[model samples]
Target chain A: MNITPNEYNEMAKKASPGTKSYKTIPAAFLVGGLICTLGQLLNNVYMDAGMSKDTASTVTSITLIFAAALLTGLNLYNKIAKFAGAGTLVPITGFSNGVVSPALEFKSEGYVLGLGAKLFVIAGPVIVYGITASAVYGVILYLFKLY
Target chain B: MSQRISKDTILLTNAPSILASAAVVGKKEGEGPLARHFDIIYDDTTLGEETWEKSESKMQKSAVEKALEKANLSSSEIQLLFAGDLLNQCISSSYGLRDFDIPFYGLYGACSTMTESLGLASLFADNGLLDYGVAVTSSHFCSAERQFRLPLEYGGQRPPTSQWTVTGSGAAIVGQSGKPPYVRGVTIGKIIDMGIKDINNMGAAMAPAAHNTIKTFLQDTNTRPEDYDLILTGDLGKVGSDLLIDLLKHDQIDLSGVHQDCGKLIYDLEAQDVHAGGSGCGCCASVLCSYILKRIQEGVLHNVLVIATGALMSTTSFQQGESIPGIAHLVYLSDSKGS
Candidate 1:
């Protein structure tokens, strides 16, 4: 895209480096932090539901993915995505949730080439590396035990 | 076409045509963020407008009332109402202004609404039919989020490139060549599509459109960078704003001393947690309502150009494998003396 010199001239004023109020700083920080805290609380809730550490982690992931998937489908998740800042992200659940939401969103286009394929558009590599790395790690641990 | 007075001109320039103007802020009530920002309180909470369908109507009516009060005009005096919003139906702007006593036109231009409204309003003003006209635009965090990415209660993280939609609305009243702050020059934006498909990153999607429009405006007007006091882009936040500077360098144009992206100017990325910046029509409009107009009142700026950028993509459009197409409009504000 190109811009004219006159347009550049018009934009110069009011373009100075400025500062926001001190009040807004803390409020945004607190709100964003609170959202993250809730994610941690959800993980704790899953742990106390009679699940082992490993199972609890899996359940948490599943819960995040499913909840995000539903919201993505209903077009509600994007609203929270706007506010709450990294609270909606940062968590491991955010990854799968991101992947599944986009895929499910495009599902109506047809399953074979659409749903099945697009489901991994963003995180396909992560899933691939995840299984591969876990298998390799398990073998290494077993060999150490044998030694 | 006589150069004399015109009825069409009166219909176009009047502020009575204003249907509605609504603002939705993200801050909880009584908690003012930017003291120097705008002269209004921010609403911090989830907003469910009874039904999503009625949201725009509710916002527009309220905004129009506020604008009318400020302009000291009545709705019956309006001949046409031009409005826009972030939603598909422009529900917040359209439905909000539906029952008004005037013809209605709806537009969707993402965050560059102030320029869009001014540009369109000026057209009617220049045409010599309208007397009073009003242009309004709006956005809401809760509404836009649910429609675009996640639910209000859904806990998800945003990438570094994501821009926060300013939860607010802004309205402007244009009349038949009256008063100090009047519509002056308008640069119609051309569609610039760079084939970028990631709707998640709007700055990249819109930077080219803004850059292209700015380039065109300068060429068409035969003006240089120094002619105006400032050149503003609609919503290209920090990352995209930097990229624009780099791109301008290639064109042998230096905007180092005079450039601002509304998204960047509206909020502090670190403080607001808006990664790239704020992207919404309100980003530009609110800043103008709060800052630029005040400066104009104070005579700090002589000539100003407001260019609003838009990412022409919807949730459905992006999901369908369509690349984002961008557009921008340029409106020039100058002194009546033309010096």
Candidate 2:
């Protein structure tokens, strides 16, 4: 009845089942690889259509984002994600979902307050950190060049 | 008069009877193992409502209406109404039962609300405070997920220990006089925190509270696990149930024989992909109001101990790195009014 929190945590750890990393890791790898391969294929196709390397890369990203958004709207992304684990997560598609999901979910609250404000609820931190880290890197690069 | 047997357990002298009960669930729950037991199973999760919150309110409203209809009483006749839901501000109960105009008591015991409300209603009836009282609670999977976890469209995999929030509602009407399946006693539980920070593993957090309450109730009543036909727990799922049996074993009590969790009972775990099992206030509420109560009414189960467990933590508290506190309330229902 008076088990310490530390003691209880240890007991609970033994009691609860953990994620099957054996299965999840492979699934994540395969799915993530497939998504990246698709992006690469799109980049090649865009380049073949007379676009430059940068344009092709940008267009490929747009295409992947569009596909992810479409899948999310159709409610297929989550089902696939359940099986794929980080396969669906550590990709451009995941970022698209992070933005689109809250936008769609909070649309019930209204366009201005709900959809707009909650648009980045999940992806906001990622964007914030990404920019902050890039700014720091840029500062370091400038200092190195001056030296 | 109802006597206090111990610090937490109370022996109800005038045993209040569960006159009528009803359960209404969504599409997923209807497709689950207890599909046939539910009174009304809506093919649409929305129940023709626009939003998931509104849908949850509609389900609660339907459950209350169905229970009242089965008892052959209107909302006006019910002296007290105890209702709650797993929503902020208890919006589902307040909005759902607004038209009834009954004196309402909105409760927020999280998932334990079903038994919490039932215990209070039984105590009020036992004390001769009211001729009729209704206890009802609900939870919606979509609504709870959006509030507590993530948006429906968010592509995130749930951990193995995670539980699916049951989209359903259950209502029970307790009267001063009725047939069998009477509320013999009640044992209120204390808050038990086990320093569990994983929100996905609610069972582990709640199992200790359940174990404490069950032990307290058995001690107060001076009865063993063998005395009851069944010991039902609310939504501990597979992981928590296993831990509960193991934890009780330390006290030289074996619950493996008669213990069953509403979480495990509600779903076909292998086929349903519900991870650990079904949870939320609606999980046990719907199961008890339908399957458990029906068996009790049919004389199949003689004595039953229902301990509904709750994880008392909010998204804010969890975000603030606070441990989840668990509570479980025990309600002893028996065919005979035991002395």
Candidate 3:
């Protein structure tokens, strides 16, 4: 109960475990690859439902994002990310985690001012530039009547 | 009234000895590579407190008490207490060390509070301002998240560049004698901003400041990178550490072999999902006290330069679209000589 500082240090050093990484990379690869496979599975399911390839791919992405957001909201995504490392982070699920995490964290500041404002704190620029480039390219193609 | 060796550098002729040091960390850090070096590791983030802020306070209190306990000295022996935290207005330190009757000087240097406080403490001791000085600093991941970024429950996807705010505390006891490792010199950093506005990427923002301080310290002390066995930066994470290496490369100063960041050394990034690595006042604070100092005591290292860097930006500043400016404080610790 009244351990001296030196004794405390020795005790803690013995009780605490060092960081182990023998299986981290393989696990990350397996989990990350599995997530991608799940995405492919969803895409195939959408195509089997008679949707076009583009539509199916988009639907699959949306589905993954939705699932990831739900997990993040339930505080389950971080747990998966913790165990899976880059497996959870490298996927579209990670993107969803990025977006939903801040929104949820800022929820206490109110919906519009807090959650809504912080919604793009991390992912704002990517979405903005991504669609902007797409729109600009689309306009250029239209000008050439490539459509 | 001390000898100024160079611009922004001080020579502590009266080498202040580190009588004792201690650290307390959270569960994640408890599982880190330096886990065994820490004094206490709480499995719970809240550390049994009602809120995260209170938990961070508890960490600081415990670290100071442990350091004092280790030195076999009472709080009364410490003439001055230099403490700080990541919280706004330094509430964590003020709230935590309230019961201690020692004269307190609260500081705020974002993540670099450890070195800032230590540097100042040694300066005070060298100037005969105090016979014994105690310095401490702390940071918690949850508390920092809620204040600087988001809440714990939020599922924000961390970027490859984002660093995990370390949940820990470190306290050091400094006096004129009674210790082997001594504080030799200090180099205070000037605020450096490369106009990086992204709050998610702190490593990039703080790297320049660290680079500047290291360059200054080397030039001021007329020492080369090879002089020290370890040249550790506080918390530049993976990205910042790389940036510092690149920045140093421009000056033709190579420290590739001996350089390491506390951010990278403290965590197993590839294993732990802490994307970039750990960053915070506690990042270097806990790591230095537990792992680095322990190595010195064991004669594993001879001289070490701890350049603790900080990104001095508030959540309000980031919200207002302001760039984050960075600062660093240097502390040279040696083992072979009487410290």
**Model 1 per-residue lDDT tens digits across residues B213-283:** 77666766667778878888878887668756765776777776789877887777776677788887767
DockQ of 2: 0.86
When candidate 3 is compared with the true two-chain complex, its DockQ is 0.12
lDDT of 2 by residue, B70-123 (tens): 999988899999998889999999999999999999999999999999999999
Positional deviation of residue A140's Cα in model 1 after best superposition, in angstroms: 29
Best by lDDT: 2
Ordered by DockQ, highest first, the candidates read 2, 1, 3
Per-residue error at B20 for model 3, in Å? 0.2
Candidate 3: tens digits of C-alpha lDDT, residues B31-85: 9898888999989878788767889999899999999999899998889999999
Residue pairs of candidate 3 with colliding backbone atoms: A97-B157, A98-B157, A101-B154, A101-B155, A101-B156
| Candidate 1 vs candidate 2, lDDT winner | 2
Runs in model 1 deviating more than 4 A are A1-147, B1-24, B28-37, B44-48, B51-57, B337-339
| Best prediction by DockQ | 2
Best by TM-score: 2
Order of the predicted models by lDDT, top scorer first? 2, 3, 1
